[model samples]
Target chain A: DTAVSQTPKYLVTQMGNDKSIKCEQNLGHDTMYWYKQDSKKFLKIMFSYNNKELIINETVPNRFSPKSPDKAHLNLHINSLELGDSAVYFCASSQAFTGIGEAFFGQGTRLTVV
Target chain B: SQQGEEDPQALSIQEGENATMNCSYKTSINNLQWYRQNSGRGLVHLILIRSNEREKHSGRLRVTLDTSKKSSSLLITASRAADTASYFCATGGGTSGSRLTFGEGTQLTVNP
Candidate 1:
């Protein structure tokens, strides 16, 4: 079974369109995260949720919002996506909120905004 | 701002050779983790070395951490073409609740 899975493996949208990506983890992890990989392959943590509660929020713009309905699911919604939003987004989960545990990552969703 | 910076932004090696990548971080960390990302796949956890530990080994992957220098190195022995991928070193600690700060990855190309 896939420990972590995200939908819409590839997404292409217009400049002003809005889109949402869904992520789910079956590892029974307590913390889930969203990371953005830019064209340079630099991975940056955008948001993190611990047991359905928002814990870490980076310097991301307000256009991107992460919602965790439960401990197993974390979804990302982007409002008015722009050209700069064209990048790969990955979903990850860890057994605990600490870094001692390894994180399981899902296949990334590549977003291309025209 | 990125917390870690990987040395030798890109590397090319023939199969059966060894690949070494270095990582330097800006702050104190509880632990350092290395991850690999294939051409179109998500990043996979390779190995981790704690701040107090000096070196660790997992199969052909060897990781070394130097807290005093705030630096780390990942060595992959007998690298194969399948090992071609971007390697990233991430530092986890600080007041952000175990949040990981990643470095710009090092792209390794293992040619057969």
Candidate 2:
């Protein structure tokens, strides 16, 4: 079974559009995260949820929102997406709220905004 | 800001050679982890070393952590083409006790 899976591996949409990306993890993890990878290959943390509670909200634009329906799923929704949002989005899960818990990332969803 | 930043954004080496990548972090960390990402795939956990540990090795991969200096290094010995991917260093530690913060990955190309 795929431990973590994301939908629509490739997304292409015009600017000012709204899109949502779904992510699911069957590893029974309690913590989930969203990371953004820019053109420079820099992976930056966007949001994290622990047991469906929001934590670690980076300086991301308000247009971007991350939702965790349950412990095993975390989804990202972008409103009024802009050209600057064109990048790969990765969803990850960790065992629990530990200091050194390693995250299992999904095959990133590449979003291209025009 | 990124917690970890890797030097030499790209690396190319022949098979059976060794490749070393360095990462520097800004704040104190409880532990550092290494991950590899192949093309069209998610990142895979390679190894993790706590701050108190200086060096650790697993098969062909060696990881060294310097807590005082807030730096770490990943060394892949006798690499293979299969190791051709991007390597990232992630640090986990925050006042609120949060998840890991990954670095700008180092793209390594192992040529056979």
Candidate with maximal lDDT: 1
lDDT of candidate 2 over A1-114, digit per residue (tens): 999999989999999999999999999999999999888878888999999999879899999988888899999999998999999999999985868487899999999999
Cα error of candidate 2 at position A17, Å: 1.2
Clashing pairs in 2: none
Residue A10 lDDT in candidate 2: 98
Best of the candidates, DockQ: 2
The 10-residue segment of model 1 chain A with minimum total lDDT is A95-104
lDDT of each: 0.92, 0.91
Specify the CAPRI tier of model 1.
medium
What pairs collide in candidate 1?
none
Chain A TM-score of candidate 2 vs. true chain A: 0.97
lDDT of 2 at B25: 89
